[model samples]
Target: MNKVSQILVGGALGLSILTAASAADPKPQDTVDYRKSVYTIIGWNFAPIGAMMKGEVPFDAAAVVRHAQYVEMMSKAAPEGFTKGSGPDAVKDTEAKPEIWTNWDKFEAKMNDFQQEAAKLTEVAKGGNEGAIKAQFGKTAETCKACHKAFRKD
Candidate 1:
């Protein structure tokens, strides 16, 4: 009915889907598919915020908060997507590099950074302070760049 209610409902549905995916004995390809879908959803919610932040689109605090919520949720959801045996070698269609499985600790640290920054971005967005939101967005984007640089392939 309301925006908050919609977010909660949507998030609950996403969590349920994630739970279902993890509960089953997924094939390697299936795991890859799941992770790809997760990232796609993250990118979907993330692009508009990025455009707004870059001044390519008008800044709307309400839109920023909504997008930040999805980004934060997906950042938390992302770890599950990087399961063992789902790397590019196994999947063949992912941009995920071998270092993800080989240098797991470092990759995990980057992921943690992303999750923390994403959460912080959501909090900053809720405050309706453009400067703080922009700063947090930069921090969150840095985490993404760090992770992508270390673990993802071009």
Candidate 2:
């Protein structure tokens, strides 16, 4: 199969496993914790690429590729954290808005957008072109912002 198909299959499998785990876990807190952990890893890996793109740090093609890989992986891993019972009503501390569940289709679309853009970013980063990587980063960040605006709280 092609790389995109492979990633889609892997992501689907990962999501199912996570959904099962969420179902098995006894508390909403467990799901919340899992969600938090996944996002933390994503943000952690995503920051340096933004720094490089912004000129806060010298551009490093290798580092961009490395960070992009993690971002892409975490994007795939993200679905596991958003199972049904993990919303604001169940876990008061989460920044995830209730609409994530209420508007599940929209939220899922945003998540898919993120996953696709992140995958594209990883592939573009591999090319080692700063300009192209920067553009891809913007696209990925736009997906994040769209999701956050519609589904997350400040």
By TM-score, the best candidate is 2
Candidate 2, 138: how far from true, in Å? 0.5
Ten-residue region with minimum lDDT total, candidate 1: 1-10
In angstroms, how far off is 94's CA in candidate 2?
0.8
lDDT of 1 by residue, 1-154 (tens): 5323433553545673343333466667767777777788888988898898789999999999999999999898888888898887677788999898898999999999999999999999999998898889888889989888888888
Superposition TM-score, candidate 2 onto the true structure = 0.83
Clashing pairs in 2: none
Q: RMSD in angstroms, all models?
A: 7.5, 9.1
Candidate 2 Cα outliers beyond 4 Å, as residue runs: 1-23
How does each model score on lDDT?
0.83, 0.87
Give model 1's clash tally.
0
Using alpha carbons, what is the TM-score of model 1? 0.82
TM-score against truth, every candidate: 0.82, 0.83
